[model samples]
Target: MSPLDDEAWEAWSPHELGQRLREATLPWYVAGGWALDIWHGKQTREHEDLEFVVIRNDADHFRAILHELEFFTVKDGTTEYLPPAANLPSDVWQLWGGDMRHGCWRVDMMMEPGTPDLWIYKRDRAIQMARSDAVRVSETGIPYLAPINVMLFKAKHCRKKDQIDFNFLRPRLSLEEKEQLTTWLNELHPGHEWIKKLPIS
Candidate 1:
């Protein structure tokens, strides 16, 4: 059972993540808004929660590692308790970890597509990259998903916060990164305004 029996959250910082998963044998990378912040080398905006990813096959492995917390599968605004020994449903990709000791939610465990050695874009599976290129380590020793991958995910949603992230990150993209994003966006989101915003050539 969840400690509080209610939905509440207090996310951990990237530093806390480093301490917790330092010895994890498989790859794990800080994801979502926090990832972008890590790439930018500072907290550029407020984050409502912390998120991280492991290869889909390793989701349960992490759930066991963070034994102090219990995981609940989140799908379309509803959450269901996921028993420790059970497998995550194929359709469920997000798990909210409840901090049993603290009586609040802590982090989100995103079970993204792709193997530990490769990164696949969830929105468009055809877009791929070597996993080494998909992740970057911060100076503080925290691993984070690359900014371009984060931006690609954000572009699909384009919520207010996503727009803010794009605004801040667009100027920082390298010529090659911008070109890559442009090509992918054209294939997946043709006529997207962000396309126009990117450099032409």
Candidate 2:
């Protein structure tokens, strides 16, 4: 059961959320479909919610700044309020945030494993990259996941929107990004339909 009751919450734009966390020192980056939109330099579709990813080690730091909002730890489709400085269980990596004052859902906070300088793919620790290479910042200073990395994550789901995202970004992928994505997809999801669809030659 979710700790927070269902309520209407206003979805915040990436810029608005970025401004709210402008003072944060810990690493956080826009993720999900929004990241793809950022890479495209335009909003291709409406987003139901905003997602931001923070290193697991910095979850507490992230909670500290967003203390005013209500947070719930999600596991196996159940949710419980996340108390101050609560240590998230090993299997759990998602947090849902809602505005208490307005009774509305706000953000989906995703936790990932990595050090301050590296990003280790949770599914396969062997897959890693320097944090600098894993993220990019918009001209306005909003940090977002690099496109190929976002596509890699989306490949796991391959929903309609995910396919749209891939179709939109495929032509824009650099040679290196295309090669890396193809290699990772082949290793992680052998025979994924996108493998044949990707424009990599």
Candidate 3:
């Protein structure tokens, strides 16, 4: 059962939900494709699920809120394979699930791995996703994925659906963003050709 009602789901926008997330979990920022859409100023296309990157220690706090929202809790403190698939990679990942006012919504949680570049000192490695400027859901008024991170995360996927998302978002990227992303990619993967090899939707 969901804490929200039909009208509640109808009333909550993505931005409002973002506000809730901010309220519930301080310092856990939204990430992935949705974050990218916020950066780009629009929703480039449809997305299957909402993705977030939270601090590793906050998983328990996030899980508690998910329980309050009536979302199914699968993993308590670790990452693993899940039954359903979304836009993310198949490798082990941690997730929480729930039905909002609408129906089912999945939250993909990636506790920042100790990648050399993910540290706080590596400010250049992160892009700011302003919640104030994110695209709002018509029904719920919550903010969702920003566009640049959407493309970056999709670029990592290199799948047909991801290719489709990229096609929708690529033309909208600013020249400076494109150049910076290209540089970031080259630095992140060193020689990965998936971005170059994938077919645009």
Candidate 4:
């Protein structure tokens, strides 16, 4: 289940997402557990909902492109309909799109911090990476966030699924990626349980 679990979710598959956003020139990438599965070349576990990240400023552009969905701003535990071309409240960084036809939620769109060229950790702006390094395109032509980065975000929320994702991908992470994740966890989530488990080369 997603943040708003009560609603039905007929979320788009990663392939479906790639197909729809294929023409989108702006930076966007599949996120959450799906990203790890893409990197692993298999679905380790069933995903509750689809999630993706895009530049906050380009959200309107995406809304214009994903016509099948009706975007809504999710703020302070409330979900409100967001009109097309409307600016999201500065404080509202999350959105949920519903498919009127199916009467179900489709995707969880995350409006991320920073510019198109640089990927900035919203929680800590000081931590940054080149967009190229942060996003990796799969052989199937789907772009996804780096598994390391995904795990780092997952660390903040220790749900059962999050733990599953972390354990499943942790061993597969390269030594460099592990060190990077370690540094990030130590800095952003000091004394995080995952830190002790991440062994460095």
Worst 10 residues of 3 by lDDT: 114-123
Q: Which residue runs does candidate 3 get wrong by more than 4 Å? A: 1-13, 69-93, 99-105, 114-146, 189-201
Comparing 1 with 4 on lDDT, the higher-scoring candidate is: 4
CA lDDT for candidate 1:
0.86
Error of 1 at 76 (Å): 2.2
**lDDT to native, each model:** 0.86, 0.86, 0.49, 0.87
lDDT of 4 by residue, 63-92 (tens): 888988888888877778887657788899
The best candidate by TM-score is 4
lDDT of 1 at 111: 83
Per-model TM-score on C-alpha atoms: 0.93, 0.93, 0.54, 0.94
Give the Å error, residue 41, model 4. 0.8
TM-score, model 2 to reference: 0.93
> Which of the predicted structures, 2 or 3, would earn the higher TM-score when compared with the native?
2
What shift in Å separates residue 151 of candidate 2 from its native position after superposition?
A: 1.0
TM-score of 1: 0.93
Top of the candidates by lDDT: 4
Q: Name the better of 3 and 4 by lDDT.
A: 4
Tell me how many clashing residue pairs each candidate has: 0, 1, 24, 0
Q: Which digits, one per residue and each the tens of the lDDT, describe model 3 over residues 48-130?
A: 66666554555556656655344332344443333232233433345545455445445555554322123221223354333
